[model samples]
Target: MRIFAIGDIHGGLRALIQLLNKMEVKDEDTLIFMGDYVDGWSESAQVVQFLMELSQKINCIFIKGNHDVWCEEWLRTGEVNPTWYMHGGKETMESYEHFSNEDKKKHLEFFETMKLYYLDDENRLFLHAGFTSMHGVEKEVFSNTFYYDRTLWEMALSMDNGIKTDSVIYPNRLKHYNEIYIGHTPTINYKSYLPMNAVNVWNIDTGAAFFGKLSGMNIETKEVFQSDDLPSLYPNESGRNR
Candidate 1:
């Protein structure tokens, strides 16, 4: 069975569907979504609904993201966060206007049930953002760190090529897994619109919430599949670029 890790969807349902179609995934394949499934494009609720149905037919591991935390809280309390509203929550809120109370409950459950991080039998680690504990993710003190940390990717990016896993100077976090997959920080910020690799860490978030495409990568082969730029699909919408 093949294993694929998908980057943040950010409400880009069209892009998400396009990326999935490009992958030609089978039921036997395992798809690990790196999170931020809502907020950004015009279809935040639709994206979640699609994923809810999609999971029933295939192996899907959903990782909760920081944005998802904001959305989840809003769904549960009806209290909108100012920061979340500024960032893509406005779009996400609008997308749910047509959803019934029952639908909202189910989606809320979907968000609540998502994993903070996932570890496979092969020692591969997947999380929405990053973690801080040098001892490894299991030792992380803050659950929010799983979806909000950037230091993990930054540490990986600044890692020296010459430092071996056996070296005392090596980051302890890197030594815990065969490979680490993450989203949150967009690769576009670094000027690349593709999944990036630094040492053993892979940043799959290709900035689908901004101007870049939604991406999916075969973890075993490192084969990439991407959708058209989100703006291209939703021409009238600014898609968080605003």
Candidate 2:
């Protein structure tokens, strides 16, 4: 069976569907979604709904992202913080307007059930954002760090040749896993629109929430599949400015 890890979708339902169709996923294939499933484009509600249905058909793992935390707050208490709204939460809120109370509850339940990070049997780590350190990554103290940190990627980016022998900074950073897959910090920031690899860490979030493609990487083979540039799918929208 094939194992795939998908990056931040950010409400790009059209792109998500396109990529999924391209993958031609089989029932036994496992799909690990590296969060930020809402808050971009115009279809946040639809994206969540589609994933809910998709989970029933296949082995699916969902990670929670910062945007997802904001989404959960909005759904649970109707709180609309400006910071959250500014970063695509406005679009997400609008997407839920037509939903019935039960439907909202279903979506909320799905969001609440999402994990901060997932570690497979093969020793690969899948998370929305980076971790502070490899030590205690599986523990509860690192739960928020799993979705909120970016230092790991920064270190990966700044390191030469992606290999670190000195364990002074982060003792187990390089030896902890076979590979690490993350989203949140888009690859566009690196001036590339494709999934990027620095040593064993892979940043798959291709900025679908910000004029880039939605990406899916084969975990075993590291092959990539991507959708069209997201803005091209919706000409009128500017996407997330921040």
Candidate 3:
């Protein structure tokens, strides 16, 4: 079976649907999501619902993103982080405003089940964002850096042709895995409108939550697929644009 890794959705349900359709996923295929499934757009609730349905049809792995953790905190404690709301949480809250109690519970349950990272038998690591070191996943679980760090990507990009200085020890933090896949940092940040690969790390968050397209990559083949620009899909609203 083929393995597909999807970047952050950030409430872009339409773009997510479009990308999934393009992938032509089969029941036997494995789907790994890097998270940030909500926030940014006006359909955060709908996006969660769609994923709930999709999971019933295929084997799905969901990684918890920073935004997703914020969502869960708000759901359980009725407290909101001002920063989160200012960024994209407002739209996410608006999306869930009219949901029934049962619907809210379902969404919370989905979020609770999301993993912080997944290590496959092939030695590939899938996570919402980069990790600090390769010591152990358990040691890094409580650190939000797994869902918010950019240093790993930056470190990879800083490498000259993926070669590091001799002073740096081998099997560095990132090299522990055969390949590392992440999505919290959008590729657009690097001025590339598509997925960016440096060394063995692949950043697939093509900025669909902003002014970019949703992207999905075939983990085994490294073939990438993208959706139409997201802003074009929701003309009436600005998606996550400050």
Candidate 4:
């Protein structure tokens, strides 16, 4: 049984479908999604609907993202967030037009039920963004840290490669997990189109919101799977490029 951690979807349902097809997931396999299921392309509602159905068929863990927070709020209260609207939220809002109020309610429940973070049996940590507490996720102070923090990844990137795990200067946060997986900060921003590792922290987000493709990584084998770049699949759409 394989265990895979999927990156941010960002409404690229076509890319997502292609990547999943390439992965050829099995019934016994477990999927851990790193969130940001909406916001970017034109199929936000469709992506949510697919994930909801997918979860019902297999073992799946969904992590909530900041973009998801905005989308969920809009679905629940019909109040649009200005920042979200500016950043692909308009497309997300518009995508729901064909759906009934009942469908919207079901989608809202899916989002509401998502976890902020997930810790696997192996002690690996999966979260949308980062956590600041040196003591680990359980000690996180900010309610939004799970989906909004970047310092954890930043610290990992800047950490000296020569520092041994047992060294006194090693980050206390890194010691709490066997491995840490995250997806908020796209690896494409760093010019890497594949999963990137800075120490034990692995970033699976390959920038599907823009020019990159949907990505998924097998946590056990470190194997990566990705779709064609989002632009290629949806040539007519800008997909949050502006």
Candidate 5:
């Protein structure tokens, strides 16, 4: 079966739809979404609904990103970190103007049910964020780490900051795996994949939330497809960190 892996959507439902339209994916094809489905754009709720519906029509593997984790926590505790709010949570909250308490609860439940990582029989690993362990243990995967260990979160943050090297600490020891697909880190170019190191880890985040293009990569072919009208939201590229 052909597998198409998509990057962090961040509520860019229109871009996603456009990309899917262009792909002309077959029913037998598998679609793996790397997560960060909510926040950043104006249609977080719509994106979630679309994904929920799409999950039924195709073989879909949904992994949770950092933004999704914050979404879950906010729903459960009614508390959110300031950094998360600044990043994209505010826009997500704004998307659900008419949502009822029941609707909110259901959405949170959906987030809770999302897998933090996915591993295929082909040994391909898909995660919203990178891993922390060097042993290639299943428990080291984000699915288990996020729920059980805070150190994993810290490692992700450190990697982002360039304070730590992922290659050194968690060498791509899963040599048996064909590739590890990840999101969360926006690429300078949204239409292509970015490599974190010499490892076969692919970062497909097209930064659609920032008006950049949405992207999809065919795992077998490494072919990329992008949505039209997707351009860098910020001309200077300075606002991306915001």
Candidate 6:
């Protein structure tokens, strides 16, 4: 069975549709979304609807990202951090015009049901962010470890400390998993894959939400597919809207 892993979508519905069309995925294949599915782009609702529909047609695994957690909170409490608006939450809210109360409820239910991490029998683990080494092996799935790990996000965003290098060392300590597929950290952080590690960790986030391309990787072959150009969202430096 072919397994295709995709990076942070951030509500770019067109890109998502185009990527899926390019893949021509079959029923036997498995599709894993690395997270950040909603927020940033113009079609957040459309992206969610498409993913909801796509779930029926293939083996789909959805891993929740930091943005997704914020979305869940906004849906539940009717309030979200103001800073999130600057980082694509505005687009997500704008895309909800067509959704009814019941539709939203169902969407929230679906979002809540998503797993924070996925581990397969082949010793491949998929996580939206890196795993917290403090959790040991089996306790990694608990909601606290999965949802509230601030250190994971801090390390992911830190550039000075060489957190990426630290992440490369982490999987060697795990006795079970042979490879970890992560997405929170964009791939631009590293020059190339480290050669010494037994654990093969592949990060597919190509910074589509920023000024980068959307990326996907075929799990079996490790062949990457990427969009040539970024979608128009933010304005250019000259103050002209894209």
Q: Of models 1 and 4, which has the larger lDDT?
A: 1
How do the residues 1-242 of candidate 1 rate in per-residue lDDT, one tens digit apiece? 99999999999999999998999989999999999999999999999999999999999999999999999999999999999999999999999999999999999999999999999999999999999898999999989999999999999889887788899899887889999999999999999999999999999999999999999999999999999988899999999998
* 10-35: candidate 3 lDDT, tens digit per residue: 99999989988899989999999999
Candidate 5 lDDT, 1-242, residue by residue in tens: 78998988887777788889989988898999988888776778888888878878888888888888888888889897798888888888877777887888988888988887788888888877666666664646445453233333334334533323335554344443667777666664434334232245676776666656778889888888887534343243322245
Q: Report the lDDT of model 5 for residue 170.
A: 47
- The global Cα lDDT (0 to 1) of model 5 is 0.71
10 residues in a row with least lDDT, candidate 3: 162-171
Off by over 4 Å in 4: none
Candidate order by lDDT, decreasing, is 1, 4, 2, 3, 5, 6
Cα RMSD of predicted structure 1: 0.7
RMSD of each: 0.7, 1.7, 1.7, 0.7, 5.9, 5.4
Per-model TM-score versus the true fold: 0.99, 0.95, 0.95, 0.99, 0.79, 0.80
Error of 2 at 13 (Å): 0.2
Per-residue lDDT value at 217 in model 3: 91
lDDT (tens digit, per residue) of candidate 2 on 78-197? 889899998899999889889998999999999999998888898898888877655637543657777888988887887767346554654366568888899999999989999999
Instruction: Compute the lDDT of residue 102 as modeled in candidate 5.
Output: 87
> Whole-model Cα lDDT per candidate?
0.95, 0.88, 0.88, 0.95, 0.71, 0.69
The TM-score between candidate 2 and the true structure equals 0.95
Tens-place lDDT per residue, model 6, 133-152, is 65444666566455344344
- What C-alpha lDDT does candidate 3 achieve relative to the native structure? 0.88
Residue 229 local lDDT, model 3: 88
